[model samples]
Target: MTRSATLDVLIVGGGIAGLGLAGYLARQGCEPTVVEQATEWRSSGYGIGLWSDGLAVLDELDCLGAVRQRAADPNRIEIRATGGERLRQTTIPPDRTLLLAVHRADLHAALRTAVPADWIRMGTTPARIRERRGGVDVTFDDGRTETFDLVVGADGIHSTVREQCFTEWTLRDLDTYVWSLWVEEDVDVGGDMVSVWGPGSEGFVARVGDRVGVNLAARLESAPEPPALDELRTLADAVDWQRPALLEETDEEPFFDRVREVTCERWRTDRVALVGDAAHALHPIAGMGASLALQDARVLAQELATTRPERVSTALDRFEARRRKPVEREKRKARVEAAVTFVESEPLRRLRNGVVEHTPILDLFVRQQAISG
Candidate 1:
């Protein structure tokens, strides 16, 4: 492949990671083609808490104002036990700790508005990707073939690009299932993010925009192929606070999935690269997935823009090197959090609760995780 003045980039998956990278690359004068499998924009009907890092990325993309208009500012976080015993409470100052709880659809819409409309190809997917010496030859599901200077697999955990390029990648099941949903009702948590922990299960409730968002997680022996709402309801029964209202709002089909972490030996191969969940799918318990995805977009865009098109491989290597350490650190923290939140042992749970109640560990953890670098 001959060197070009501008890099022609192809991004798979049009979700947060793909769209965010597209937005950054576009701002750098790179016209990136984004292919999304969905025919239309899908609303997740769930909320995500974006820390300062995520907000900074949106601000750089000039989408922060729009996101703020659709987001809620939770002033604090409250952690409690199954019997409604307060374990820890941490205050989140807007100036100090920037945490915005926004609906997933709203955040996606903000990112979508940042990119060129024509750049996104809906209902499209790549059928084959062949990496030649110069560029990657991609065959789309619609039988269209295109060659680009760079191909990015920002397509979440089960990325086709990663599957094709990095065959050694594996997904580690966390032996947990999560259910999340949003309801149009008031949840009086005093404008705070409330988390209720029980044996082998946990629940979260927060006021997002004008709706109440609820997330429930439970530890299981094996992955449930078809998760039943009744089983989720049974887990909800284990908790007292926020049970009745959350159960009342639970739909027949809420967002349900098994929690899995993506582990890969490498994030790049020649000109093909992986970003976001495609490279490292951290457990949602860390609340860093979206933020890290945004960070990946920014770093990868910077590296590619600064490097010559002929040195695209070097840029990708730098992108991976810059992201690997922090991502791995967060993954470890998420695993620890999962253990504490879903511990089944009575004595261990008591010890964890006692430590949280007495020390500033929760506050320090939140603050530490909120920092981007």
Candidate 2:
């Protein structure tokens, strides 16, 4: 097999992972094309927490400074019981990097600006894929077929690329749902961030730039979907916290989704590979979703930077190996945090809170998640 001067890469999904990878690959002189199912460029969530590792990747793509300008750095977190009893307040050490909080739309815009407009195809979906030596042939829903040295599935949990290529894999429901909103009024959160944990539910408020981001996660008894905002309020009302102000300010619709996890035996097959939520959708409790996706893009870009099209398969394998351990560890942390925050048993909830209050364990764990990839 001969090496090409530039490899053509097809990226599925226009979310954080895809767009971020497109920018990184373009910087390496690879011809990257992104196909988004949505007709226009948009972001789904309200605000995202960018950890140090995620910010570093954005820095590599030259998009961090702009994003930083539009974001708020939160340095402290206040943990409280559902009844507003203060459990513990952890102030991030001065030497540690503060988590940058920004509206998802702003972050998306920053990434989009870095990627060339021509490379992204809006209102498009990959209908079919045929992998051959040194490349893969992809057919779009619009009836166009193209061959690329590499095909990346950066789509989220229900990814088409993953479904078609790794048919054996599936998303595991965590039996929880998350609903979040970004309100114009800044809800009076005591610290940089506040997380209230109660029986069966957890609520978080973060001051992101000029807006307040409120998130509510609940463990459902049955598999029925989470209720709408009005019903959600009733459910959340079971716990006591500063929800009235947050709810009053929440004029725009809330973003709702089920909490699911994806574990793949392999992240790649042939010249095709998965990234971001497509590869491993961890619980959002650890706040590593964006960071992990950004890290995935960075690591994949690094591996692909020095490889030829003929050796792309090996490069992808190396990318998977280098990333898999860290991702799995992150997934484990997310699971543990989810269990602690959403504990329904009153006794278990109190025990967890007592541990958090009496020991430095929870803070250390949070710091570990925040700093490491």
Clashing residue pairs in candidate 2 (N, C-alpha, C atoms within 3 angstroms): none
Backbone collision tally, model 1: 0
What's the residue-level lDDT of 35 in candidate 1? 94
| Candidate topping lDDT | 1
Q: What is the TM-score of each candidate against the true structure?
A: 0.95, 0.95
Candidate 2 lDDT, 332-371, residue by residue in tens = 8888878778888888888999998999875786668666
Off by over 4 Å in 2: 1-5, 94-96, 223-227
lDDT of 1 at 195: 88
Clashes of each: 0, 0
**TM-score of the candidate numbered 2?**
0.95
**Which lDDT value does model 1 have at 219?**
91
lDDT of 1 by residue, 1-373 (tens): 2223289899999988899999988787778999998899987745677888888999999999998888877778889998678988999766764788788899999999989999999999999999988899999999999999899999987898998888878988778888888877766754368889988988888877677888888898866665567777778888777766677864646788888899999999889999999999988888888888999999998888766667899999999999999899888988888877898999998999999999999899877867752
Model 2, 158: alpha-carbon shift in Å? Answer: 0.8
Model 1 sits at a Cα RMSD from the real structure of 2.3
* Models, CA RMSD each: 2.3, 2.2
